[model samples]
Target: MAKHCTIIQGGMGVGVSNWKLAQTVSKAGQLGVVSGTALDQILARRLQDGDQGGHMRRALEAFPFPVMAERILKTYFVSGGKPAGTPYKTIPLLAKDNPRELAELCIASNFAEVFLAREGHCNAVGINYLEKIQAALLPCIYGAMLAGVEYILMGAGIPLKIPGVLDLFAEHRRAEYGMHVVGALEGDNTTMHFNPADFTECKLGSLTRPKFLAIVSSNTLATTMVKKASGRVDGLIIEMRTAGGHNAPPRGKLQLTDAGEPIYGERDDIDIAKLRELGIPFWLAGGYGHPEKLREALSLGATGVQVGTAFEFASESGLREDYKRDLLQKVISGTAHVFTDPLASPTGFPFKVAQLEGTYSEPELYAARPRICNLGFLREAYRTSEGDIGYRCPAEPTTVYASKGGNAEDVVGRKCICNGLLANVGFPQVLNGQRVELGIVTAGDDLVSIAQFLPPGQSYYSALDVIAALEKGCSVLST
Candidate 1:
């Protein structure tokens, strides 16, 4: 925990920020982050694909718990990958009462990801999780901790209790997180619990409590994190609407622009002055990928910039080669269109989507993909009138969502983000008749500038190129 990293590679979801990207970034003297979101599924899918390059197998072999790793590999590893177009084995959804196998996969998969990322590098590796995915939080954290993950970065929701959970797990104690059931009555139980001892594979000692960085868009939330968090607030990641993935809703009343994106006015600003007054390190996200912008943020008292869009297109990133190639070409031609879709994500947060013709961003493609919720990561839990806890996602079939107490209006324009994200990293699902997964790309407003990383006559770039551009200043780069 010697704080020297000035750049943090954002942990893109559904396997986008895989070990390759994080390891490359960390090797270059920066913080490399692996997305902890749905890593169990990612590992399973990778194992199903024959554990290519033996990277997954290597990590699993090093996993402290050999038996657990063996079980996972035995269940999912395919000899030469399932015959051509067969569908991947389905995984159960995480809930207040999760299946033991699902929990074990969560722990093993997270460990494997972090272990691989930290391989051959002493530089700190971090794991990113959305607090909105509450049910699987405890075990994931413990699993990452098992691999000595240095940082736990969480956002997409207020995560006041996570720091405390980190504290508990590091002490080898049990931790409980109350799942936010939308309509739970007073005194009804909705807690998710995890005890480290139950899952330990060998004799173990207390773990190191990783530094916790809570992503926030406002000074209010930053201050609240330090003042009200369950334990130590290591730092803050101040992101803006222009960043990729889900964005914080505009402050106060929600308003939409003519383009159907959130209308972020003055009130939505993070108030850098107030943030400075908080007396802790904070990284500026959004359009801060350029050298000049990074310099400006440091001048304004930021530790560094949490950059996503730039690193996201790097050769090491998990983004499919074709998707990266197409998007980068559009960037070079100045034809890339990024839409901040308000209804695409089931979590009700505005999701930034890069409009690509061949992907789900296209009208016909979106319309043709049958609505399904097999992943269920963004499913919302609510209390039924009959005193039972129920889960529903707006992205699920309109009829099914409505039957579970979800409103019809909530389902409009909602895409299957879970499936679409997996597709972005080349792990898309395959159904009958050769139907394939489609990509739904998300990027920041800085998508156009990613081309700057390219060397003369080259159409692609690497993670080092991005770090170099930011550190040396873009003005130094020759066209």
Candidate 2:
């Protein structure tokens, strides 16, 4: 017999669903997930920031590969911290043929995040990744597996090949993921490969193949994943239009409401009964932050619920204090509004945004920031005229994005989500006149629902509070 839960703390990326938050939930006997997206860069930045609270140092010490840990520490660790106003050094952008250092960083960084989250907890922990961020997949998965991560939850794109990659690493073999290069002809080489032998000096350690859960929005994609995936997909997470982070685009031609939000109609509704016919475990997301919702999911035959907005504002989460405070106040007042912005993300998926002042979601704030593309995480790789590959992001400068085939109109109100997201977790970069560029914050449509997690008269709630609220009624499903 094995343990399962009726609630999963959804993986919020760019350090929002951090180790401490995840650990808190997992310790309370529910599935806790650490966001594995952009962790390599986040880890490097943390090291440069003097390894705050010595937590990174502890995780690095626990890393199985001592030499790899040593190499990363020697390269990125600053004794005190980088001076104020001096930007953290950016690592080279990940390409099909990555530099060895970048590859190592990906592995070590992913390992550290999961390792820290699982520390002192025998309960299972999970890692989440967006399939669109393909560059770091192999090493990132490898590192999480190395850290004994119990589950891997992925969404934002159909990940047809990830299960095979997990199997390869579990067997201590090399894993190769095909990169989706824009404008590449049928015969063009676009596969990225990672061999543990190349990086590990000794024989590779045996790794466990974690449970694979594909996040999906509809029954059609769920069926496709079950029937067409390269390997075993353990489960599915059914995220509705209301979930936080990126969302699946509406089917057919995109239509907008008078308020500018993407219109989700009858076709967008998921057929849960059809989902059950697939014979796989599934969790319901989006507005599923309440205990009543958990019961509804169970009654409907779901294994559990995956929640984001509530846990996101918990005290232990990595969201910055000012933003969290403002948002929490709104939640308490039942006035927080989340709009499904269709143009904010480079991936072109409908991104959920909290309407906060001074954030990139605000028109004035967005207009004030100059267009730049330093992060490049969201840059798309395309085959150049000479058969070389080039990367570009629609959120970059208008002239540059246009030259790369992006339509100026399509990018009109688009904000650079990469930098903004990084800023959300307190690493906002300072530009001219000490103006900190703000990243738009994304949360589930149940923004006001977070208030339920807080006790009456309590101004703040802990991750435990969220878990308790979610687990109140069903004892058997609590763990």
Candidate 3:
């Protein structure tokens, strides 16, 4: 067994970096992470799809509360899967006032994902969540802790309160997170709370607090997390704007090129020397997927490099085969196109989008889809005029968003990413009984270089191919 490793497999969301992919990397002595975002939707859809080979049921059997597991199985599992062209049954969206059943689904679904990823190996496994998705944070962390998740890495916002939540959950104590509200005044009591005792009657022991790594973009954010986090700060992952999914906006006035991507300047550069002085282990993400880039990161005082694009196309990754084949062919043909869409994400963070013909990146497909917000994870809470909390998503209908205090300008270019990402992994919702959801694939700028992992004639690659390529001649790679 290796004491220290050099790769932190990127935790791509909505089932892209799933159990099969995580298990492969962890078993090889690296930090394999499953996307903890949207597991509630992933779990229910898996059950409705017949769980295809009983994988979900097998993991649920290991859940500490068999009663809870049985309840979830009974409610969502379909024997032969739903009829084609029929939509998945929607569960209630998560909110501070989530129904007891809805909250349980979040917990059980998160637990099942981590439990399944941790099986068939003794190595450590981690789960990744966005700090912005606060409604389900408490129960989701508790569920992951129940499966002994070894690390919790978060980004997409300042996660100053996460380490403390981990501390409380380890002791089986109740935990609360102050939900971010847009128009709340001082003394506002907007918060979401959870307790393990509410779910299980079995006696429990204190769980080990997993290491916390705050994913950040600048030295300032890194220093802020180190000096201001609620509990111990374990490490950091410095991801640049080139990484897939949501990227931290560049500092200062938001300027864009004539082509429309956000311009990154010297202010965007993180001072490596200053960061190394913090004496905390860090990893470099965004375009650092090559062998030389990996070596360069290690030489710069990093623990390793977090690679997403390479592993995202691996055999074990959860991306549908058609999308993989389509993208890989583009990579090989030198025509793979990725655009950094500044306004597509409702979080106000720039989202990386891979341009594909039928995906949501297409103007036609993006325009044709109705503006409906079924999944509300990205919706923000605001204080209404009556001092009551109200929720709205910029991606939702324009009239509805305006009625809830959202500016009409914010609605432009916004897409329903929650549903779009799930569709990328083969569980796209069937809408209107006549149309199937279109996928919106996200990859790092290194999407073109993924061709290196494949053979000269081969079209696809496996997880080991990427690990071997990055670890070639590097002593940190396991033999």
Candidate 4:
């Protein structure tokens, strides 16, 4: 079960793979994921910023569903910390009929971040997500399988019903999920249910399915996720186009490179022997984070390597330590750059971008911030010429996304990336004069090879020192 570890840390999302960088890469055995995306609005803004070192009250006192962690700590804690310029309150919009305390704070904030990154680790602990955030996939996979999460992953899209929603929480039932919606029509009502007995109040302990993977980038999306997944995917993370946050774009029409970014030639080459004839287990994300690119992705066959700009500049990543000390001093002075940007992600994919100055990839700091969509997690539920189902955001306010049908030139320069990736992890959104904004950080293009996961002079390193220098070899493939 130790899956030949080379490293799989790459789950950097809104809170940049928190829970102390997935418990220091699952206590060094390697695979530590945990970025269940907007983890219930980053666990309700870390319990309205008061649950500080109590660490979401110690992962909601190890939630095994204790009344959904006492009803999400009696509705998002907030006992002390909300004053400093006042903002953490917004938890409402997640429709398709959500409520019941936002589905128990999306299953106790994805079961307290996969129960504190599988606490004191027994090793295996994965949880990523972002199949275009389909209405928080069944209370975030029933809160990361009620904290036992042993690998789910998922990509930016084409997550063909997430292995039947992990076989309906390993059979404790009620899963539903279909909501992509955009135009709606053939009898409408786009699905979206979830009933592990309507949020488990008692007899429910079943969940053990996990193992899904699917973060593909080609070889035809890894042979269409092993011939159209709906139940058992269990592999593939391919990811290239120099991976970091979101990337897979360039195949035909879109070209860019004069530093605008995208342009991936050789027809975006990815055939690795047709992905080794699609026989399950795979891994190998862009610029494959170190150690001779994890032995050149295990001599071209690969079942290892998923790093994210070297565990997103490690020191237990949830980023923002002055943006990891100014991007690790521009990656130890080689001057960090990163840009895959294709209009910086409103799920328009192609998004690496990190030439940071005041952030938002600096076009004068993204034209001095302003466009404000108040964190509607990549909104796009469409269909409202009166037929209802609203939610817009192509980074919002191009006249409220052209009054909801969107397409004012498809939202120019997009960038809301959920409140700038929760203001690149120091939880931004403060508005109305006290300022704040500044986020734009995304990673890969080997961001100056993360100074080879720093150590020579030790600038800072952790996710178990970048998975122990990529399991003891190092130079991640000369960028």
Candidate 5:
């Protein structure tokens, strides 16, 4: 039997949970997960920044396909990084019918990250992906598998087909994911296909199928996944509304609080009793970062808990030093606050925004920024009048979004999450060589409590510090 991991480090924003953080947590004997979101773009930007520390180049040298690895290095790696104020070159946005170059980038980039994270440790590592980003899903999974990823966790949608894709990919066979296209007629083709053989230079043995853990918010979703998922669902992470990043919208009619946040009622709560009846290992998320909460989870039949906010500010995470410094200061002063903004995400899901000045969370800063959708990670696919799939984002220019059949109201209050998240990790794109993108910070409600991990007289904490604290919590209660 596989040993249970008592704690799973949360895979956070953009590059925030990059290889370094994940590797640190995994080295501490817990399951560490790297954020699989926008990894291709992150890898490209890292190379363009001169592959600092020679880490990207090191990982690429170990990639199975030398030709593919060489192509990526040649295309993106700069001699000493791009000049300050110069815009980072953009990769093509993903689509149902993606070009070969984009697919190769996804595969190679994912491979490099997982490869690097798995280095210097024999412990298992995981990768987290948002199911909504379907276009790049196949190649990304294939790349991670090439680096021997042990777990694949997904949330943000009904991921019924992901398990089956894992099965096919393990045998090095072709895999396809059905793209969800809005306003599609009965016969529209919305399937994305990828084959490992097409991208490989030589024959290879079959790979192991990584265990799949679907992140769910309700008993209904969990039950549906266990009973109807195309293949075996190894486990689940039950995330509450208080968790960081994109939250599952509240159940039933959308009601807002007086403060403009979504009102999550009793119905929004997941029934732990029902989840226990499913006979699978499950973890509790959201506000379970404390020792008492970890103890409570174990007593309630949970396999473990996944923590985000605490690890997010850890010294090894990819979060920018200035932002981390400011947030930690707020945590110390009790001035830290998180707002669950209902209209900020283009996905229309509620996103938690940590109150930080000079970020997009500020009303004045948000309004001053121009609406551009060049990154296009969050664009929704819709059937055009020509019966072809066209992409649109509410965060795009108002007139441009409207011309693509998007509602004017939908565009209201929508912020460009793609750009904001990238900027949070210090890779913001420079538009027209002058307008630099600003970042928006996201953290769970537990952001205020992360001070417990800080050493006496120290402003920052490490992943080992977090693991020791949570493990001590579990140990104290177990004794």
Candidate 6:
């Protein structure tokens, strides 16, 4: 049996669960998960910022694909960072068939992240990816495996084929993923392909296939994964709607409470008894950051608990200092509020947003920002009238989305999540050498209680503090 971690740090945002935070937690003897979302952009932006502390460079030096690494460095690594008022260089958006440049960036970036996170530690480190980012999945997973990642966890969509992709990559074989294109004619080709041999400079024999964990919210989905996945699903993470980032919509009809939040009925609740019968290790997420909640999860047959909101505010997280300071202050003042914004995410999934005045959570702030889709991480794939796959994001300009056959109504409250997430990590894109993108912070409903992680006299806390606090309940239960 594979070893299971009692505390799996939830992979929060674009760069929130970065290598620094993951290394800190993993070195402390728990599972530290680096967010696998938008890593290509994260790597490029950090390099443009002078590759601060030479960490990215250090990791790239160890990357087996020297030529690929060199290419990325030459393309994005600015000597002392870009000019004060200049916009960061943007990479091309990924699509059904990505350019070789973008593919190489995706691979090298993911490898660098996992490599650095695993530095100075023999303990297991994991990379978490949103299964919805299908365009980048192939290259990204290949990169993580190259760095010897121990676990791969995915959420935000049903990842039934990911396990099989892992199996193929282990042997350096060709792997293809069927892209979900909306309104594709019967004969349209909607498949994305990646072959390891094509990208490898030299033969690097077989890679160890990492364990796969599918994050799901329903018992039926868990059972389906166990029984029908393309390859072995090592475990599961049952995340409740209260968790941070993009949440699975409530089961049944989309009924909302008076406050406009989705109402989760009995159908949304996980049947722990049925879950136990699946015979796979599982973790419970969403509001499971507290010691008592960890204890409760264990008693109810969970392998452990995955906590995000707590770790998100920890000192090691990659969140920008100003934003972190503002949010932490709110938490301390007992005024931190997280709203489940059903219309914010381009994916149409309900996204949790921390209510901060100056951020995109405010009506005025969100309206003031110009709509752009340069990053394209959250764009949807659709069949164009010309019989080719095209991409569209509702958060883009209203006319742009409508021209691509999208409903203008879908663009009503949609925010540029890709840009907002990048901004959260202090890499907001500047347009026309002016207008800076503002960030939209996402956290679990438990954001109100992160203040508990702060010591009595201190206003800040570390990832270790959060881990130790959650483990306290388990230790006491054992006693």
Per-model root-mean-square deviation over C-alphas: 2.2, 1.8, 1.8, 22.2, 0.7, 0.9
lDDT of 2 at 160: 92
**Residue runs of model 2 more than 4 Å from their true location after superposition:** 432-435, 473-479
When 1 and 6 are scored with TM-score, the better candidate is: 6
Q: What is the TM-score of each predicted model, taking all chains together? A: 0.97, 0.97, 0.97, 0.33, 0.99, 0.99
lDDT of every model, 2 decimals: 0.90, 0.87, 0.89, 0.79, 0.93, 0.92
Kindly report which residue stretches of model 5 are placed more than 4 angstroms away from their true locations once superposed. none
Error of 3 at 200 (Å): 1.4
CA deviation > 4 Å runs, candidate 4: 1-35, 43-68, 75-85, 89-107, 111-142, 147-151, 155-204, 218-245, 248-256, 260-263, 279-362, 366-419, 423-428, 431-433, 438-479
Candidate 5 lDDT tens digits, 1-479: 56769999988969999999999999989999999999999999999999889999999999999999999989999989999899999789989988888999999889988999999989999999999999989999999999999999999899999999999999999999999999998988988889898999988898989999999999999999999999999999999998999998988999998999999899888899999999999999999998889999999999999999889999999999999999999989999999999999999999999999989999889999888899998999999999999999999999999999999999999999899999999999998789899999999999999999998998889989999889977898777
Name the top lDDT candidate: 5
Clashes of 2: 1
Residue lDDT tens for model 2, 49-87: 888799888988988788989989998899788777767
Error of 2 at 447 (Å): 0.4
lDDT per residue for candidate 3 within 250-287, as digits (tens), equals 88899999989999998889899999999888999999
Per-structure clash totals for the candidates: 0, 1, 0, 4, 0, 0
Extract clashing residue pairs from model 6.
none
User: Model 4's lDDT to the true fold?
Assistant: 0.79
Ten residues in sequence with the least summed lDDT for candidate 2: 470-479
Reference-based TM-score, model 4: 0.33
**Candidate 6 lDDT by residue in tens digits, 23-101:** 9999999999999899999999999999889999999999999999999999999999998779988789989899999
lDDT score, candidate 1: 0.90
Question: Candidate 1's error at 329, in angstroms?
Answer: 0.6
For residues 101-166, what per-residue lDDT tens digits would candidate 1 score against the true structure?
999999988999999999997999999999999988888888899999999999988999999999
